[model samples]
Target: MYIPAHFAAGPDVIRDLLTRPSAANLVTMTSQGLLATFLPLIYDPSAGEHGALQGHLARTNSQWSEPAIGESLVIVQGADAYISPSWYASKAEHGRVVPTWNYSTAHVYGKLAVHEDPAWLGNHVRQLTNLNEADSERPWSVDDAPERYVSGQLRAIVGIELVITRIEAKAKLSQNRPDKDIDGVVAGLDAQGHSEIAADVARARLGS
Candidate 1:
C-alpha cells in the first residue's frame, strides 16, 4: 500500500487488476479479530460512483456471520516477481541495495452487508461459477446441475454486498529503480524463466 507516485497505478490499472476474472483475498474484522478468505470478486467501477460493491460469501464460513458490519478489505493480487539485488546496476557500483518484490495489488475498503435472499444468492453463485469456468475448454454452467441440488447448496452459503468507500492500488514494479536497473531486473527475471514475475515486471514497466 506504500505506493510512491512513480509507482502509483491508475484507474486503468485498477480495472485491469480485477479484470483478470479471478478470486481475491477478502479480509473482514470481527469481535474475534481479522478473518481472511479467498473469494471470487466482481467489481463494478460504476458501483463506486454510487458508493457500493456487490459480492457474496458462503454462509457456512463464519467470516460473514459476525454481528459487526465494519469496513472490509478485498485484495486482488496480480503477477509478482522477485527482483534480486544482483539485478540492480547500483548493486555493483554502490552495494547499498537489497532485494525487493515487484508486484501489483489492489485494496478495496468498504461497507459490508450480508444478504440471505435465495434469488440474490443464487444469482451471485451462478455468476461466480460462470466467471470461474469462462476460460475452460469445456466451461461448466450452473444450469448443467440439477436445480433442486444446486438450490440446496445455495442455501448453505451466504451472500454479501459490499459498498466500496475507497480503493487504493499500487504496482510495485521497480519504478524506484533506475531504467538500467529495471532493465537488468526484467532481463534477469525473464532469463530465469520466472514467467509470472517477468510478466508482472513487463506490465509494471508499461504502467510506469
Candidate 2:
C-alpha cells in the first residue's frame, strides 16, 4: 500500500471501507510457498475500541490447510474505475495527462489465529451470516436452519481470526490534482457513465 500523503485516509474512513467491502483477499506464507484465498470477512468490534476480523475458508482449500499464526495480509478493495486522459483538462491544454486508476484499497497486516473448537466455529459462522445479511429486508438466520445440518456444514470449513496490528488505507481519487482539475475529472467520469468512480471522487474531495 504505497499511499501518498494526499491519498491517506483516516482511521474511521479505513474502518468504514473495510467493513463495507466485506470480501477480502487474505494472503499467508508457509514453508511451501505463498497462499491466497478470497474470503468474506466479518468485522467484530467487540474487542473494546479497535476491532478484530473473523472469517473462514473451505477445509479442503490449501489456503487454510496449514495454520500460520505469524503475519498475514488481508486486502480489501473498493470500487475502482479507469481514468482516461480525456477526463483531464490538462489533456486538452498541454496533452500532459495519462491514464490512471481511481480507487480505494485497504491492506491489513496481522497475526492469524486458527480456531478448531466446534462450538466457537459454529458461533463464528453464524455471526458472519448475520453480519453479512443484516441489511436485507427478510434476513435468514443460522438458527432458522436445522442445527444438525448447520453443524455438519460448519465442520467442512476452517475458521480464521486475524489479530490486526496495522491497517493502511488509500483512496487514489485524484487528490494530487488541483481543485479545477479534480472537478474536471469528476465531471468527465460522470459524463462517461462511471458514476461509481465519480462518487468516490466526490467523497475524496469532501474528505479532503
Candidate 3:
C-alpha cells in the first residue's frame, strides 16, 4: 500500500477493480492474532462515499464471531508479471537495471457488519453470482437451483457488509521506468503470454 505518486490509482481504478472478478483477501486483526479469508466480493458503488463490499463466510468460520478489532482490510489484486532486468534498455546500456514485479492492487478499509438473515444472504449470493456470470453465454443463476436447496445453502453461510471508509490503490506497472524500458517490459510480457499484465503496463504508460 506504500504507493508513489506515479503509481497511485484513483477512484475510478479502485471501483473498477472491486467490480471485476478479482478475489479479495479479507483481513482482520483479532485478539489472538490476524486472520484472512479469500473471497469474491460484490461491490456497490452507490452505497457509500467509497462504495460498499458484500460477501459471505461459512457459518463455521470463526472470523465473524470475533469482535471487530479495528478497520478491516480487503485487498483486490489484478494481473501481475515478473519484469526481468533484461527487459530494460538501461540493462544493456549500463547494466544498472534490476528485476521487479509489475502489478495492480487496491486496499479497501471498512467497518465490518455481519448478518445472518436468510433473505439478505440469498439476495447477496444472487448479486454476486450475476456479477461473475455476466460474461458467460449461458449464465447460471441462484434461482436455477431448487428453492429448498438454495435455502439450505444460505443457512450454511453468514452475510458480510463492509462500509468502505477509505481506499488506497496502486498500479506498479513500471511507471517509474523510462518509456524505452516500459516498452521493452510490455513486449517481454506479451511474448511470455502475459497479455493482461502487458496491456496494463501499456495502459499505465499511456495514462502517464
Candidate 4:
C-alpha cells in the first residue's frame, strides 16, 4: 500500500471496496512462518469502530489453527489496468511520462478470532451465501440443503471473525496526471475493454 497523498483513499472508499465483489488475501504470521489464504469476506461496518470481517476456511487448512501473532492483514483488490506512456500528453510534449499502473486496493489489519461452534459457522455461511446470491434470480440458502447434510458441511469448516484495527486504502487512478492525460487513460482503458478501470479513473477525476 504505497499510497501517495493524492492517491490516499478515505474511509467510505475503503469500506465500499471491501464490500464489493473482491477476494481477500488473509495473511497471518506464526512461529513457523507466514501463511495466507484467499477467500471472500463479508464486511460489517456496524459491528465495530473500524469494522469487522467474517469469512471461513476449510478445517484442513493449518493456517487457521496457528496463533495469529500481533496483527493479521487482509488485502482486498479492485479493478486494475496498465497505463501506457503513449496515453499521456506529456509523452509527446517532453517524453517525461513513463508507463505505470492504475488500480484500487485496500489493506485491513485486525485481530483474528476463530469460531468452531456449528451454530456460529452455520450463521456465518448463511449470511455469506445471501450476500453473494442477492443479485440472482433465485437465491440459495444454507437451509436449502437437508438439515443433517448442512450440519456436516458446517462441521468441515471453521468460521473466522476479524475485528478490524485499522485500514489503508489506495486508488492509483491517474490522480497525479494532468487532465488531458487522465482523459487519454480513461479512453485507452475503455477501448481495451477495461470499463471498470476506466470508470474508476473517471470517478477519481471528477472527485479531484
Candidate 5:
C-alpha cells in the first residue's frame, strides 16, 4: 500500500473498515504458491492483541486446508470512485488538474488459525449472520433451519481466524485537494450517485 501521509486513514476510518459489515480478500502464502479467497468477515476485538478477523471457507476450498506459510493478509476496501478533472474547480482555473481516484482500503496481516469444532463454527456463523442481516425486514438465523440440517451444513465448512499482527490502511479521498476543488468533487460525486465515496471525500476534507 503506497500511502502518502496526507492520504493515510485516520483511526476512525480504520475502525469502520474493520467493524462494518463487509467482505475482504484473504491472501495466504502456501507451499504451492499464493492463494486467495473473498470472505465475509467480522472483527473480533477480543480475540488477540490486535484482535482477529473471523470467517469461514467451504470444506472443498483447498486454500483453507493448505497451511499458510509466514504471515497471511486480508485486504479490506471501502467505497471507491473515479474523480474527474471536470469535477475540480482548479480545472477551469488552470487546466492543470488530472483525473484521479478516491478510495479507502486496509492491508491486514496476521497469523492464520483454523477451527474445526462445531461449537465454534456454530457461534461464528450466527454472529456473521446477525451482522449482515441486521438491516433486513425479516432477518434469517441458523436456528431457522432444522437442527440436523444446520449441523450438516456446518460440517461442510471450516472456520478461519486471522489473528492480527498489523494493519496498514489508506484513505485516498481527495484530502490533498484545496477546499474549492473538494467542494466541487463532492457535488459531482453526489450528482453521479456515488453517495458513499462522496461522503468519504467530504469527511476527509473536514479531517484535513
Candidate 6:
C-alpha cells in the first residue's frame, strides 16, 4: 500500500471499510505458495487490541487448512471509480490533465485463527447474515431454516478470525485536486451513475 500524504485513510474511513457490508480477499503464504480466498468479514471490536475480522471458508477450501508461514493479509476495499480528465476543471485551463482513479482500500495484516467448532460457526453465520441483510426489507435469519439443516450447513464450513496486528490503508478520492476540480469530479461521477464513489469523494473532501 503506497499511501501518499494526501491519500492516507483516517480512523473513520478504516472503520467504515471494516464495518460496511463488503467482502475481503484473505491471503496467506504457505508451503503450497500464496493462497487467497474472497470472504465476507465482520469486525469484532472486542477480539484484540486492534479488534479482529471474523469470516468463514468452506471446509473444502484449502486456504483455511493450509498452515500459514507468517502473518496473513486481508484486502478490504470501498467504492472505486475511473475518473475522466474531462471532469477536471483544470483540464480546460491547462490541458495538462490525465485520467485517474479514485478509490479507498485497506490492507489488513493479522494472525489467522481457525475454528471448526459448531457453536462458533453458528454464531458467526448469524452475525454475518444480519450485517449484510441490514438494508434488506425482508432480512433472513439462521433460525428461519430447519435446525437440522442449519447444523448440517455449519458442519461444511470453518470459521476464521484475523486477530489484527496492524493495517495500511489509503483513500485516494480526489483529495489532491483543487476544490473546483473536485466539484467537477463529483458532478461527472454522478452523471455517470457512480453516485457511491461520488459520495465518497464528497465526504473525503469535507474531511480534508
TM-score between model 3 and native: 0.95
Which residue pairs does candidate 6 place in steric collision?
Answer: none
How would you encode candidate 4's per-residue C-alpha lDDT over 7-75 as one tens digit per residue?
Answer: 998666676797875568999999879999999899888767888898999999998999999999998
Q: Which model is ahead, 2 or 5, in terms of lDDT?
A: 5
Estimate the TM-score for candidate 1.
Answer: 0.86
Error of 3 at 113 (Å): 0.3
Report the lDDT tens digits of candidate 1 across residue range 72-155: 888888877777999888988989999888888888888887889999888877777777788899998999999999988888
Cα TM-score per model: 0.86, 0.88, 0.95, 0.94, 0.98, 0.98
Clashes in each model (backbone N, CA, C under 3 Å)?
5, 0, 0, 0, 0, 0
| Candidate models: Cα lDDT each | 0.78, 0.81, 0.88, 0.88, 0.95, 0.95
**Which sections of candidate 1 miss by over 4 Å?**
48-54, 92-96
TM-score of model 6 relative to the true fold? 0.98
Model 5 regions lying over 4 Å from their true place: none
Reference-based TM-score, model 5: 0.98
lDDT of 2 by residue, 3-25 (tens): 78988987756877767737889
- Candidate 5 local Cα displacement, residue 112, angstroms: 0.3
Alpha-carbon lDDT of model 6: 0.95
lDDT digits (tens) for residues 38-142 of candidate 5: 999999999989999999999999999999999999999999999999988898899999999889999999999999999999999999999999999999988
Stretches > 4 Å off in candidate 4: none
Clashes of 3: 0
Candidate ordering by TM-score (highest first): 6, 5, 3, 4, 2, 1
Over 1-208, each residue of candidate 3 has an lDDT whose tens digit, in order, gives 7999989986666766888876789999989689899988988878778779999999999998886799999988988889999989988899987889988898889999999998889888998999889999999999999999998999899988889998889988898999999889999999999999898888888883
